[model samples]
Target: MLDLPSILNLSGGPVGLFIGSFLASTLLPGGSEAMLVWELQQHPDQAILLCSVATLGNTLGGLSSWLIGWWLGRRYPGRGLSNERQRLALKRVTHYGSPILLLSWLPVIGDPLCLAAGWSGVRLLPATLFIGLGKALRYGALAGAMGSLG
Candidate 1:
């Protein structure tokens, strides 16, 4: 059983990983990959737990961003995307719908894709499901890869 120090030792373990993953999944300017990788290296036995926690945290963060976009869509009915970049993003997601959320794990545009889906009024359940799937797959792959680093 891991304790607080296990979580706090290397800039916080699983808990810290959850928080970092959550923020990184948002539009915020941060990346949890470094911390995640470091933690995985330190605690190889906890890989599944760590990855699951990260995925959950990240999915929640993506949902927060999606909900914000939904709120914006509600708050500003007629006021659509303010700029060309957002417009283009809206176009891409609109072309594919919820399935496009598979790319929500992408680097630069992933968060915006979720935002676009919300702004464009994509269904909530499917979008959230796809987002979670994409994130889980990403974490699974990363952790699987990390398993070989020993």
Candidate 2:
């Protein structure tokens, strides 16, 4: 007797939230905000667990893009930025280093930032820290907003 929203909203736990968050953080076209909000609405007591799960999934997805960039860097050492977007991402990554990953939760440019950080050889530890922190903050903010609304 479960409805579509019930299923998509992950009535069991935060597992679907994790998967949706992961795909959302990647270059893939999707988002987990709705799912997060729904999960929060369903399990108000488990806000921390839901946000943490979402952040972890999102951070890993960003790292996956970083890994792809690392492989690409090794494969094509002489590759050039083919467009303005890539050039801008590289410029920001080079100028700000892994600290720029604090903005990795942003859409449109977030995925590029992760890739550029890896391509420019930003240290994994710092990148992971910043990416996770940024994602955690975002989810925290969302939970806070939900708390206020409800």
Candidate 3:
């Protein structure tokens, strides 16, 4: 039988946990929070490193989704989006600008939000900054919660 505690600890380690969490943040469905918290409990000394890796991994995954969206936008040229929907989404993005990225921390919609931003041809630098900020906030929150519980 697999040792659940050991498995959790390993999965939550700096490299393994980061990769898993990062991939999960993309279109794929997975989550690393439990592993992260478990690792924090098991290895307090590694909390900061774990948190940083998780955040960077997640950000890169989100960026991958954004790149996919950007590429699709170029190839498809908004073919799938209705004019009205495009207009409305565009208006929201334009009005709110980078702040909309804060919502990227949300569950189902968060990944799509990043994708949509790229699809909308949002400025690359601003989009990257906002995504990074949102991802950092998420990791910080998770780390804080884990610290409290630990």
lDDT of 2 by residue, 7-81 (tens): 665543687888889989888978877888888888898899989999999999999888877778888999965
lDDT, candidate 1, 58-105, per-residue tens: 998888878877889899989878777667778998888888888888
- In angstroms, give how far residue 29 of model 1 lies from its true place: 1.3
Total backbone collisions, model 1: 2
- Please provide TM-scores, in order, for all candidate models, with all chains considered together: 0.88, 0.88, 0.79
Separately for all candidates shown, the number of backbone clashes (residues 3 or more apart, or on different chains) is 2, 0, 0
Top candidate, metric lDDT: 2
Candidate 2 regions off by >4 Å? 1-12, 148-150
